[model samples]
Each structure stands twice: as structure tokens, then as C-alpha cells.
Target: MSTVPETGTLALPPLDGLGQLLPRLSRRWPDRTALVTDERTLSFADLDRESSRVARALQDRSIHPGDRVALFSQNRWEWIVSYHAVLKAGAVVNPLNVMLTGEEVAYILADAGTKVLLASGERLDAVGDELRAVPSLEQVVSFDDCGHQVEQFSDLLAVDDDPGFTPFPVDPGSLACIAYTSGTTGRPKGAMQSQRSLVLNCAYAATMHGRTSDDVVITALPAPHVYGNVVINATFMVGGKVVLRKRFDAEDTLQCIVEHRATLLEGVPAMYAMLLASPALEDADLSSLTRSTVGGQTIAETVIDAWESRSGVPLIELWGMTELSGLGTTHAIHAPNVRGSIGVALPGVQVKVADTQDVTVECAPGEPGELLVRGPIVTMGYFNNTEATAETITPDGWLRTGDIATHDGQGHFFVVDRLKDMIITGGYNVYPAEIERVLIGHESVALVAVGREPDPVKGEVAHAYVVLAPGQQPDADALIAHCRQHMAAYKVPRAVHFVDTLPTTSSGKLIRRHLRSSATANA
Candidate 1:
């Protein structure tokens, strides 16, 4: 018997690196539509040629092997080209979240030692002088025409494509990406993933999801996210078309499924919630969707059942993190649907629940513990942060996923809670410490602690408990406005509670779990 149920006839292609993905697909399916957007559509051949031209431009700029090239833009065709172009140039990719503040972007760029920055003109202008502070940045390329000191993305694409161009040969074990994930320490850390890891993830995800040439997927997930990256690349790996959107609008998404005749619809739970809430959902034609996927956070079984029942499609729940490169566990399309569970591990990956108190001990079935993963899918470690790497990964190579999960005897894993205080708001990881750091910056804030608040749409939202300084009156609006300015919109607290004292241990350590009770008592 197969470790995973055989779902589809789509076989994994021989891929050593992501750089080879487009070139190989273009050769076999040159005329097949590979990417579709409202702005334009690209055949496999067109995508390959455009990426080659951009790769030559990057090489001309002296972007050598292992050099960091950052793409800081929303989902766009150019963003896709830049990704493959960076790989073809034998450079490491650093995809930045478009929602990041100028300060946050600067920190990541500087930390990754990004040499070339490819972004939208608006984002560059927003960062303005901050880009200059990063000494490692040698060139700034914008997708749109911008002010001085930046190269135009169109100009690079206009360059003559090297007929003999091919992806630079690099070891499969070599680092291919530095994905920055926000940590509990109030800063983002880069997860270094190898070329083999990424390529395998795409292959496995595509195979398990039953993606093939006949499939067309619609998604609005950010390209910078590992989940989004896999969804995009997995489609390309099997010669499928992707109807990529810059942002998620429930009505628009439902319409796209009908318009594109999409076979797969993929998104987080919040997206499904919004889709269910949309008035268009009742009249929208969803006959084409054979399967859909939800991940990035745990979703209620009710939401999954409601979606599957209404659309006549299966909602395949999967679980993963940035450290896993893409997916650690997901359901095979042909397998039994196990609602409220994240299915089983991908074929070659190993997953086990270790006792929270003693990681060396494996938890019994139905016993919740910290989910530990050991496999090639795991990231090498946090880039330039050995201390964090050691803390997260054991000497034997088991990656502590920081998720409290229980393994059913039958191979399914059910997530219970987060081992860390980090909140998942609309599928985005919101570190409480990061929020606390920003909220503490406010002049009126004396002591602040952030915690997860249950949200029907977002799964969980950040709720802050504040203990104001002496002589300061409660100003929830002002404090929230302050966070809005310093952090991304998603990371902003939905509500703030003014408390006389925050719940803490006798040693003065703030307890995040008790925050909801404190809010209730104060109210």
C-alpha cells in the first residue's frame, strides 16, 4: 500500500531546483496558459522567456551565486518572473510581505543583506530614504516608473533574451530562499530553505492535491507567504494555470472561479468565512471547483462542512509553517476527508507529537503535545541566528513546530492550541511580543500585554490589555491608532482593554493565557 493514498496520475517531474521548473514546463507545454491575471496572461513559453531576460539583467548587475535578491511587491506577473529570475541567476530569493512597514522592510532587507530590491514604485517611494540606510543594497528596481536612483522593471524585461540562457548549476542542498517569519522575540527571523526542499514541496503538494494540466487554480494569498508560494509553484510544476489576484475579495474570488472555470480554489479559513458571508455566494456558479484547500491556521469543522456542502467540493485541510518550506501535512484528494484534522504527513516527511514537558518522550494517541517534524522538508535553520536555530531545532534535526497537536491512532493530527503566545489573525502569524513592543512605544502606555481573542472571521484576533501610566486616562482609540501607524494592518489589535493591572505571575512575568479573563473581569 502507498504511504499516501494515490490521488492522481500526475507524476512528479525530475526537478533539482525551482529554477528548472519553468524552463522544463515551457519545453513540454510551451503553448499552455501558465498564468492568468486581469492585466495579462502568460503562456509557459512567455513566462520562461521573460524570466530569462530578467535573469540576464540581474547577472549584468553582478548578482552572483548566493547573493540575496528581494522582491517586495504584491502578487503580480512581474513578481512571478522576478522569483524565477532570481533562481536562474543562482541567487537566493527574499520575498517581503507588501504589508510590512518601511521600518520592518528595512530591517529584513538589511538582515538578509539583500543586494537587489525589486518592488512596486509605490512601495519604494514609501520606503524612500530608508532603502539608502541598507549599505548592502546596490540596486533598486521598480515595476512602475519611479523617482531617481531606481531601475525600471520594464527595461529589464525589454533586454534581449539570451538564447543560450539556462539556470545556473547549483547544489540541490544549497540555500535557495530566506523566508522571514515573525518570531516571539519581537523581531522576524529568516528560515533558510534549500533548493531540494522547495522543489520537493511543490512536487508533493501538487501530486497530493491532484493538480494536473487540466486544473486551473484561483488564489489571492500573498506571494511572499510560503503557503502562497507553494500554491503558485505547485500549479506551474504540473503545467496548470493560476488565476492570480493581488488581493482577496470574496465576491471577486467567487466570480473568478466561474469566470476562469477553476478546478481548485485555495485560501485560508478567513477567506472561506468571507466567501460564505458574501451575498454573491448564493448566486455564484461554483460547479467547476473539484477541490479546495485551507491552511495557515486551524479552521472550525462547521466552516469546512458548510463550504463542502454548499459548493459540492471537498475542503482539504493542510498544516505547515515557513520552516517546512511549504506543507508538512495535507490530505490527498482521493483520501477520506477527516474534518478538524490536518490529515497526515506528506509521503516522505515524519511527524510526531512530543510531550510538552519532555520532548524526548512521544505522546500517546489522543494526547496533546508539541508537534515535532523531522524531514528534508524542514528548513536548514534561521539565517544568521544560530541561537534561535538551536532552540527551534534539535541536534538530531527534529524541528519543534510550536503547535500543540494530538495524533489520532489512525494517522490524523488535530491541532489543539499554539505552544507560543503568537496569534493567527486571518492566517497571518501575529506575534504578541511584536505587538507589545509597538504598543509599549506609546507615551500613554505604561505596561501592555497582547493576547489572542476568538474571532469568527479571522479565526483569532489580537486583543490588548493595557495598564496605563499614572495620570493618563484610558484612550483605547489613541493607543490603537498608534499601533496602526507602526505595524501592518493585520497585526493591529482589534480591541484594547484598559485594565488597572495585567495578570502576571508572582515573579512579574505577564501571563498571556489569562488575558481574556482579565478583560472579562475588567468589563
Candidate 2:
């Protein structure tokens, strides 16, 4: 096992405001590369100066501290600059995913009570009119000129940097960012993260990953999401260079790795699956890569093994959520024996297992239960939704993570499944991840999702949707028989549907709701 850092017990500093850290880092690593988009690279010094200019421009427009600013764009250098610029002015940032519909975008803007919006010219048509309709939004700033309704981002950069602007007095508990969940449920609720929570999470990640100035981190995920934001900001916090990708493409990612000689790679499981299947990967030189990690969804061991076989680097599985600021548990790169586990609790974090009744359970090795987390890294609460906030955070400060997991005696945690994803069949509880993991081990299976199929007698039964590997043929009976060899009969999938591909979210999480709906529609 890799030696954990010797940070004796949780005597952390009263979280200093991010407003202070950004300026300090800017002064320390001014010449280092801070962000790299497809078309341009911004050094730390350039990012610092440009973001200061943006702060001044916003202030000149009467935007003040405690106001909410929205950023709706893909991962780009401008996005990074705008994020910090919003924070520099002590304003709250609301980053909306570009993949959202106009209505979804409108809901978030209104919910956050956003006063200003910063977006790219390419995405103007998608939400420009919708944002105009929001009464709470006082101003709209665009990366390019958009007639009268938008302020040009370049014009903002041309303004004189405000070196004399007084820093806002921000409390550690004040809202810093409102990141909306993917809305797998009904409407997405904004997860409120404070500057104290976000900065502490970044520091924890830096310690776990052993990040340094020499590491070049490639962020291929969208910045609007929590996973992408944490990785990008954490890289900067450690004085590492970040190579950004607007959209994830297997060939482009391989080329970026080779061209930039990237040392660290952060992506979700779908990105890895695509890269493993890409023809470009066969010829690409991936020798520069050393550290690679994945989160956002549960990853099958088969994918991990395939990636390690190809790249000579283990795919460290991480477990986190938007409320936790994107890191609660991560597999230690230095500890290869715990490759399938989500390593130990990150430095300054505590994790435990609780039964269905919310009682703390002393789980023996290999037993699974709901995972509960408490630490400086956890978010304070949801924005404005007091009911939801109270339900999520305990009175004692522990955040009930709705993930089902098991831990080995050695302290390594493996995600069994999601609490909501558990299917009840004949009164027997079944976790889809267990079935999915077993199915992926089959040679004929390329990708798979295990979900519940409605049954009149049982309410719901286990079902599998699988994509077959090219030229490999396997019938439903054979697949079921194969599963029987590794699992109990009740836990085996009752029905199987072969598909071309499983539906996944933009971030590469399998859209299980789609699967359920598809099964119902087909029936």
C-alpha cells in the first residue's frame, strides 16, 4: 500500500477565501502555462492580468460583490479566465452546461437569480434569446460581438487592469459557485459550493495525486460540470499546465497527448472506452502519460484492465459528486494492489457505511452499504432550497452520499452500485453494477447496462442491454448461463437486449432512465 500523507487529525486552517489564493498563485507562477485551448494558450501571468481586466470591466458596468454571474460555454481558455474573474470580484459563478436545452438553461438562470451571463458566440443562438427572456439577468456578455444585447469579451480585455480595486470582504460560508446536477431526476437542483469547500477539495486532490509544477494535466471533460471544474482548478492550484478540449474525440485526445507530452490525464469511463476502441490509439505514442484517473460514474474492471494494458498506466477509479466538490475518494496511483477500489478516504475526509435505515453498520470485508461522508471537502448545502439542504446534510455535518459501496479490510472502497439503481426482484435486492461488472468480463460483451424491467408480479426485474464485440456472437441464454457461473440465480439478468450502443450523458454516464423508458416503450 502507498503511504498516506501524515496530516495528523483534522486541524485545518479556517478556510481562507479563494479571492486571496487566486491572486497569490497568479503572482507566484505568472509565467507558467495556466490554460491551453485548441486555438490558444494563456500563461498564468496572462490569465491573471486578463481576469483582472474582466473584473474591472464588470465593476465598471455596476456589477458588484454578492451578485450572481453565469458562464455558459464549453471548456476553453476564456471560460477559465471568466471563472476566476467572477471569483476575483467576489461574485458567485453559475456555470451552465452547453448541452442543456434552452428551457433548462432558463430554469437555472432564474433559480440562481443570475444578474450577468458570459457565453461564447457559437452558443448564442442556443440560449441567447432564452437568457434575454429571464427578468433577473441584468446583462449578457459574449466572447464575440452579438449586436446590442451582448458585450464583447475582447472589449472587456482591452480595459485597463484594476490594480486598486478593493477586495470584497467574503465570508468562508458565502456561496462561491452553483453547479447544477445532471438532472437525472426531475429538474436539476443547484449544488451550492463555498470558496472554503472548493479550495479545500483542491488541496486534498493535489495531495492525493502528488501533483507538482512539472505535471501537464489534460482536461478533456466539459468545464461546466463539477468534475471538469475541480480538475482544472486543482491543476492550477498545484502550478501545473492544463490542456483543454472543447469536445472529446478519441483521435484528437490521442494527438493532444502526443503533441503536448501530457503527463496526467483526467477523463470519465466513456472517454476511456472510446480511446481503447479508437484506431488512432494503435499508432499514437502514449509514452509521456504517467497518471490517469476517472470518475463521474462507476467504471468496470474490464475497461480498467484494457486501458492499463495499452498505456502501461493504471486507470485510478475516483468516487465523488457535485456536492463534494468532485473528490471524496480516489484510487492511489502509488497503490496498484487497490486498483479496483476507490482508495482510502482523501486526506482530511472521513467515510463510513450505513444500512438502509440510516444506522451506522460495521461492514465486514466485502459487505456493501450506503456510503456516508464528512469533511472540509463536502459542500455546505444546496442554493436556496432549504428542504433539500436539510435532507442532504446531517445535524452532525456528515453528508449522506447516496452511493452503495463495500470496503476491503485494508481500507480500500469499491462502489457496489447507486442506492437508487438497486432493483427489487421477488423481494430480493439486486445491484445493477454487480451484473454489469460480470457481463463486461465476458469476451463477447463490448459495453453493457443493467437496469430494471417492469414486471406485473415482481414490480421490477433485472434486465441487461449489451453491445457485442465485432465478430463475437453470443445468445441471451449463453450470456445468462455465463452470469450464473459468477452470481446467484436471482441476481442474474432475467432479460437481455442486444443494442448498437448504450445511451450515455454528455459526460459519459449511462443514462439508465433512458434504458428504463426504452424497455417500457418496447414492451
Candidate 3:
């Protein structure tokens, strides 16, 4: 009964070649500001020319069509340029998280079979050894001239543009990027996205958000993630200007929003919490912002009410995942009928609830079940992992989103929880099993269960319930130190509660849900 277009059958323009699209959009916008970082501003024309130059440089390095090039850097103008350059050169872009450990980096590079990596100088040290370890990576390009072994990114731009290099012809279904999602099992699997998937998602997001050329978007999320990628793509689709921040700093975010008069903002719930708690929230001139959107995790009604009261702007909630290309459901700002619900499915998307048997079920008003989504925006499949692909995507093409949700009679949906035991801390997914496996190896830990504990800013923080071996004891500080030595800093527990025994089922399997509930209640 929704007026929006039908699911999976929307007639979208064919997006066969991203290389051609960027140039054409540049011509249309011409002098319009396309990107603005802390240090520089690039107009559409500048982006076109520079990206072309970078594309030619990529070709000079033998990065040909279909090659996968990893981009490991923070949010910066260079990151944008690199993204366009890779696409223009007909290579797939694999953006790596700056926070990932060397082992994780090696796993991704080896898994994706990446040929080259473009990294910031500061991040080079973290992955230098890993890059060397992976024989498939032939070259390393650095954004800064650090007198290192890596090629300078600026030097690449100085290369003469190749006039004869024709843009490669590609089908809309050809792979565009392989975004890796942290797997519940072992290693992460790359969610293979097509050219159509990426382009259509951006267009749809822009349309849903009512973005215009006059809109100024401030992005605090890291570009390596799908959320940041979608925001950048959407902004460009509408010829909107973007203000990039390398990292999220509450005070700096306030200053940037005020100074740039940012009209739109995309952040996670933690960011909003920080901004609201900061002293600058009361004094900063945030009047320029007309829309503020939060996603990656849930937003409490209390936080929403407080933010709306202070900023005089409603906070829109979005529900999406990396596999969905960064948008599935959004709370439309202008919708009068469905106010609080994650607005009706975006154009060309279909949502249904399924029982444990995977059969579609109609929720009578407020009943919650597993949320299943099917659409063009959904990923083609997990790259190189047929088993995972089969598990996530049905034979009929519906993608099992693994989240629990309920819908009102009016068609508005509300997400309840995720089926996977994944923790979303500070907007980043942290799997407890991964951390528990590492913790149990510690000399002081006999049994350990990692779970989520409620936090004011992050919504949930990693909490560890540890039981030491008999006659052996490790303090909270020491156990935390041990975790930091074994895993990424964010994966380390923010708080460790010493316990005598961990709750387990009759079969001797650890019951993580009970541990999580106990930890939250006691916290």
C-alpha cells in the first residue's frame, strides 16, 4: 500500500561505468565545490582533473582493469581522490580500516588478493611488515613523503594524464568493491558489491534524504566503513559539498559545524552523545544544521529527545549494514504519517519478517521476528566464500539481514536486536567470541566470556566476565593489559569483572546472552 516504487523491479538507469559517470557529473557541476577537507577544498573540475591524473598514474604502475587496490587511510581529500582514481582506472577499491591490526590487515590483503595499497604515512608503519608478508601486494603508495620505501601519492598525481587510455567497458553486474564484514565464524568475508549496487544505493540514499546541491554534509565516520562510503557517494550524486574530519573529536566537530555552516551531519549515536555532553553543545552555533542523522547502532529515545530539544532538529535513525551497501531503512524527515519508525523501506527494497524456519511471517502489529530484506542494493554475494553466500542470501535472492525487528500496522519498522552475538561499541562491530578466544589463552584466565555492557556514549561497551584458574588471580588492570597485548585496542574490554564461574548450559556451552544480561544489569 506504500506509494514508493516496487521492490527489486525498479527501473534504474544502467550504471555500467563509474569512470564515465564521475567525469560527466563533474562537467555538469563544473565549479561547484565537490569536497572540502580540513586542509583543502576541491571543486568538481579540480576533482575531475586530479582524479584523471591519479588514474593515469595507476595505469603507469600496471594497475589494470579488474585489479583490486587496497586504500588504507583516514578521511581526507586524498582518500576521495584515490577512490575516484581507482574506479577511473577500472580497478576495484578496497578501503582498509586504519585501526585494524597487522594480522587482520594481512588476512584481508591475502584474502582479497590486493595488488597495491594506498596508505597514509602515519599508517604505513602498522602495515609495512604485513604488506611485505603478502607477496600479492606489488606496490605501496604513501600519502606523505616520509622517506619510506612506499611511493609518494603526490608524485603519482604529477604523472602526465594518458590521453590514449580509454575507459574500460564493464557490465553493471561487474564487481565494484569487496567490502569485508567481520565474520561470526573465523576470518571476515568480503561482501562483493557491483557497480549497479553502489551507484543505485547512492542515488536512492540521496533521494530518500532529500539532498540538494546546497546541502553541506559533515562526515565524522571513518571512510573505510560502508556508512562513510555511502555518505560520500550520495553527496556527490546530488552535487553536495562535504566537510571531512579525519577523526571524531567532539570539540572539533562543533567548531567545524559552526565554521562551515554544515547543513547535514552523519554520525553514530555515540557522536551525538558526545556532542550533547560537551560544553560546546550549549554555546556552539549549530544553527546551520537542518538535518542530523545517526546510524550504525540504535539511538535511545531519551538521547533523541534531549538532542531535539537542544538543537531544535529531529534526529533521523537509519538501519543498514555493510552487506546492504549502507542503506535499507531510514526515518524520513518530512514524513508526517510514519514519524518514529525507521521509515518505510527505501525505493526498490522489500522487507519481511521470517520465523525460525525462514518462512515469511506477517507480524500482527508489534510482534518481532528476524528481518529479511531483498533488493538491488543488497550485496551480490560474499566474495570467494560460497558457503557464507549461501548462508546469508537465499536461493531466491532474499538477504537474511540477521537483525530482529517489528513493524506497526502502518508499515513502519523498528529494529529490536541482532541475531548474531555481535557487539556494537562506539559504532564499531566487536565480536565477543573473537575476544574470548584470545582471553582464554592468557596465563591468568581459566575461563572468560566477553559481552556488551551499557554505556552512556557508545550505547554498549565491551565488558569481560573472567574466571581465573584456581590459586591464580589477575586484577582487572592486568587482565585488560593482557587483552591489549593480544587484540586491537577497541576489542580490549573497557571493564573486566572478576568472576568465580561463567554460566554455561547443560551441554557445557557458554551462554553468552545470559552473561551479557547479567553484565548490563550489574553495570
Instruction: Kindly report which residue pairs in candidate 2 clash with one another.
Output: none
lDDT of 2 by residue, 386-407 (tens): 8888887888888888888888
Better of 1 and 3 by lDDT: 1
Better of 2 and 3 by lDDT: 2
TM-score per candidate: 0.81, 0.91, 0.79
- Candidate 2: where is the Cα deviation over 4 Å? 1-15, 146-148, 163-169, 335-337, 360-364, 470-477, 516-523
Clashes counted in candidate 3 amount to 0
What would the per-residue lDDT of candidate 3 be over residues 161-255, giving only the tens digit for each residue? 65555556667778888888754458989998888778877777887777877788988787778788888878877678888888888899889
Q: How does candidate 3 score on lDDT? A: 0.77
Error of 2 at 99 (Å): 2.1
By lDDT, highest first, what's the ranking?
1, 2, 3
Model 2 Cα displacement at 302 (Å)? Answer: 1.9
Worst 10 residues of 2 by lDDT: 4-13
lDDT at residue 84 of model 3 (Cα atoms) = 83
